[model samples]
Target: MKQSKVKWTKSVGWLLFLMAIGFFCLQIGYLIIQPRYQVEYIDNRIFYVINMLSIICLYMALLFLLTWKKIWTVVVTTMVTLFIIVNVVLLVERNKEVKNISSISPNLQQIFAIKQDTETGEAMYYRSYYGILSRPKDRLEPEIAGDYKIEWLANDIAAFTYEAEDQTIQQFIGTYGDRQEDSMSYYYVASQIRGKWGADNAQVERQNNGIAITVDDQTELFGWDNVEQFGTLAIVLKKNNEAVWAISLDENFVANSEEIEPTVGNISLYKATMEENDPIVLAYQGGAF
Candidate 1:
């Protein structure tokens, strides 16, 4: 009976030790891949839940290793229960706060929000525009007093700048004026058309001056300015040997091809536009191809 009791104690200790290691690995992995955007709200929720569970597991493992007894087990169980309840309450409050903020600040478009700890008042603030997902709001040091205030300013800057860029692209594309609702990039739009029509002989070429389209024995050229003539850009698609839709950059406009993030270049292609005739229209507003 004495030997059996010793063996049981060793087995319990080893099991708790292994569980602690497993929990630690889980916590490390979560930290690595936690979502940073409000667009990934589901992922954010899962990360938080897993984090809380890992903490509980680690704490239980410690308790078990320190005192292998029924009382320690009871203590750990009670702590886990309390921790779960508290976390759930916090989650509910956070969801409510997010909803309220969204309704009140319709323009803010909360991509992600960082809540302050009720006890410790610390958080990492974040906001995002259409730029690369991981880019910071800004690099300049702010004159703001608090972290939250500084973050608010950063978000405002990013949003305003991105909004201006968006307006510029739209104006260049002439989406509000002569251009039809259905428009897309020349490359994608042409490929889609060719695929749909089963025209294996169709070809598209991007030249220094503009784009050239050839089908069978016929050829047509749509003129655009070279890189030196910044902002003189246009996208054209032809179907049945005729131009379907075309948009060009305004002559007065200047191209801003500066990179937003490390690898992502400036905005060039407008999003895929669909027309009544099922044509995909894309506009080359500005920047490199």
Candidate 2:
């Protein structure tokens, strides 16, 4: 008589093994896409707990298989299932990187809060805006140079970061269709720095991904939409100069119509600065007509 041993089917065991292989394969791929933590410090603690749990699950599955336990299939299946879930989570989101850099005063006179750059590992950062940095060759065409200009001015904030050279600038008195290359700094400058003086009831026009608004009788500006609200003009003003100006121009080079001075200073994209009868320093942060 042939005794029948526990006529156990290896099918369940094979299925679990295959599932485990798939889960681990995906897990390996996920690790590649995940960001490596350079510092041991972690932002979230729950994630660490999840990592430990996964290892335990994997271990229990192998033990069940070796013992020929009836629940081995379920245990292994759970392991693969957990792996699939964890792998998905790992690919979904990564941590943001942080870094530090030196803080130079606005006038470029002195340095503060020195730190290393995350990307290059170099020690460099920005503080104050002196006169806009320009290469000698970056000057505009002679004819176009008559309208816009970049130069230094005095400051009110008295902080190192607020000591940027005031850019006293002007633009072509019309909407822009084509971008001017040589005078791009004027355009960038006009859009970035802001003027505070303007009638609240102003004409704000927006077109072609550009913005234009009138601050008052004296100032207006054309700008790139994305950077306007980024705290550039306000930050610069608060840091360097005591006198402040701003313009709330529209996205399409349109004007605003309010009773108040829509502009922050003398103009919008076109900014003029004064320091106790000093020469007017105009800077343009965006495009011109």
Candidate 3:
């Protein structure tokens, strides 16, 4: 009877230990999954979960070892073996996916898939006349008293300057004077404006009745004039001299990315327009694909 009681106590203790390990692994999983901006963290979390599960199985086997219980030993051994096999398979797949995403036609897929593909009947982005998402918002030095002020913009009738939160914004194509009931009409005007800018930048674009299609501009975007274009600089759609929608290249427009916390190049942090319907966030994990 005493020996039986000891065995029972051992079972309970092992159960608790296994439970604790599982819980710890879950916490680690949360840390990895919640931070959507990290690619590696997501991958790491997956591996750790498998590892924890394996440990639990091994621990159960050890408990059976103590009691010389054949059934328990078999169960634990089977669990461990299964988990190890699973982890190996997943690790192989994970590595393959990472390599392709980092190397292949990353830019083309991001832009076309997230926004440009009209066949999907999805529209998270709109074109812009003035390059609102073009350059990083000019900001004051860390020690300086000045803050991020949207100071100046190139003078053009197509695009005008406005103010919001001390940020002087270059209003692209939309209804500056009056709002239009038809959203398509507004987009048309903005497209024309974008076409004009494309020319100034020495790039060519196609303007349809209400749709403006932007082609590739010959100029180098990043590292031009010793400036790096982090995310993307795409066209903005305007109507009645107001911006209706602003289209981003690979990802959404990011505001002052150079100054934002947890900074990455062209991560599509936020929209500069402050519109209610800003472009959606695809994945914060990688910037501009």
- Please list the C-alpha lDDT of all candidates, in the order they appear: 0.35, 0.32, 0.33
**What is the C-alpha lDDT profile of model 1 across 184-275, one tens digit per residue?**
32222221211111124444445555555545647666554311111124443433322233333322323332223121111122221222
| Candidate number with the higher lDDT (1 or 3) | 1
Residue-wise C-alpha lDDT for candidate 2, range 52-113, written one tens digit per residue: 44555455445534665668668666866687577556534332122322233345553322
For lDDT, the strongest prediction is 1
- The TM-scores, one per candidate, come to 0.30, 0.21, 0.26
Error of 2 at 281 (Å): 38
- Measured by TM-score, how close is model 2 to the native structure? 0.21
Ranking by TM-score: 1, 3, 2
lDDT of 1: 0.35
For candidate 2, the 10 contiguous residues with the lowest summed lDDT are 133-142
Candidate 2 CA-lDDT value: 0.32
